[model samples]
Target: MYAGTAKFPVRKGKNYLLRIVNAAVYNHLFFMVASHNLTVVAVDTSYTKPYITDILVLSSGQIADVLLTANQAKAKYYMAAKVYTTHSEANIDNTTTTAILSYVGSKSSTTPILPEYNDTATVTNFREASDVAILQAYHFHIDDVYTTDFPSNPPIEYNYNGDVDKTLWVPISGTRVKVNEYNATVQVVFEGTNIFQADKPSNAYSRL
Candidate 1:
């Protein structure tokens, strides 16, 4: 329940490199700074082509390196991390972990507009494997937020309608994980899906 921490000072026109690590035990974070945009420089120990984005989402064990330039007006801003929910259960942390980004010689502080704690629909969609970022990356890129090199696509567009295929809709109780080698090149779909299976479509439906 540590809602906020000490103030971090900055000066106008200076740039800072930050290592943002998500080491939480059971939470994911959506981090942002009030009135500031982050230029993402790296992820999980690998240097990525710099990408600029406003809100960043990171799961436990993930690390993001971002460049922050103090180019805004000389004032104080809130840099905050709030929980991003997983599972479609009725649970969440409505509190935020915040720290002040105070510009030297500034007098006022403005809190950032934090994102909603957990939009179950979006989270469920992400879990459902239908998010645009995830679906689009099925061909040559990433899952959501992380970038990956290419692997051939499913070779054909396959459909899975859970409404008709009850047996194929969910994973059995015990979760079996597949391990990959270090730096292995493979694409994994964790929603119990294998769209490449050429069996009856009724046996191909999967859901999270």
Candidate 2:
């Protein structure tokens, strides 16, 4: 959702491919359209096995391409977006940003009701994804073993089938960068998503 306003017009009986990006500074996003179902076709730059879902779960740096059909009777519907806050104990954003999915000739005041702030089931169903599309970020496949005492797993045993609770969520003990060695194979997967990096020279992180 845009900061100031969110509204876009579309013609009826047309299929629209939405290039949705979760560019949140530090939060995942759950996006949906009122009275419409999204056919998710792609993610990032790769095409996914087409699946239909009312809600889309996106990481901060992830991108999804969904096909939307304006099949509903010509009327203004609400396109809602809210932060997916199951990663933590409590929600930080109370405002669910909304936009109007206006049919070129219809008007209405009804808005789409979004999911709860801490809806984990939807997020889990989306996360257990199966990748399609013969595309990868890198061409070369160099498998190397990680060498260090750095924690490679989450600090807790996370069960996606549970409700939102602070005690259920994993807690990061602290940032643990690997030790710098002269000649060692590095196999690390960095999740720098949902974070904003400034142009300052300092190596400080806004979020750990």
Candidate 3:
């Protein structure tokens, strides 16, 4: 399944900058242009060393500027984004969204190949969740909005990367807040829980 279609008309042998943003609230997406290698130039509004890649792994709210050279055959190609998940049992929408990259005077379009949902070996690297509403509750001291009982340690320890028990797959939800001293240096270490819904909150404001 897919959403709206957007078309981009380009001239052959010319370069174009594609600013891609992953705005999904809780989806880690893999984006690509058919038969094209995109050179990533900037990430999160900061310029970076040029890195050419065939596929980009975008977490929620990530912004990437890539340079695309229209040097392939003069035909339209599909630019697509699809969901990527690490956990095998995680329930997610296995669908793709697409746009068109059409060459000047080209009429035919080719379907782009997207990565599989559980293509863990292909994704070596890694959204938004209810953080904003939780923050508002904290600022207003609204105790009912969220609870402070978020666990600091695992309730039951088990093999993290190996086969996990189904009981530990879903955890109790709460808005846990930590109060820090003024001007204190803080270091946050995010642990991967191997659950897609549980991991999204930690990676909400990530860069590509």
Residue 103, candidate 3: how far off, in angstroms? Answer: 0.6
TM-score of 2: 0.58
For candidate 1, give the lDDT of residue 70.
97
lDDT of 3 by residue, 88-155 (tens): 63578887888899899987778878878878766764211112256676787755545666555656
By summed lDDT, the worst window of 10 consecutive residues in model 2 runs over: 193-202
Residue 77 deviation, candidate 1, in Å? 0.6
- Model 1: colliding residue pairs: none
Q: Give each model's whole-structure lDDT.
A: 0.67, 0.68, 0.75
> Candidate 2, clashing residue pairs?
none
Q: Which stretches of candidate 3 lie over 4 Å from their true place?
A: 1-4, 125-208
lDDT for 72 in candidate 3 is 93
Ranking by lDDT: 3, 2, 1
Tell me the TM-score of each prediction against the true structure: 0.56, 0.58, 0.57
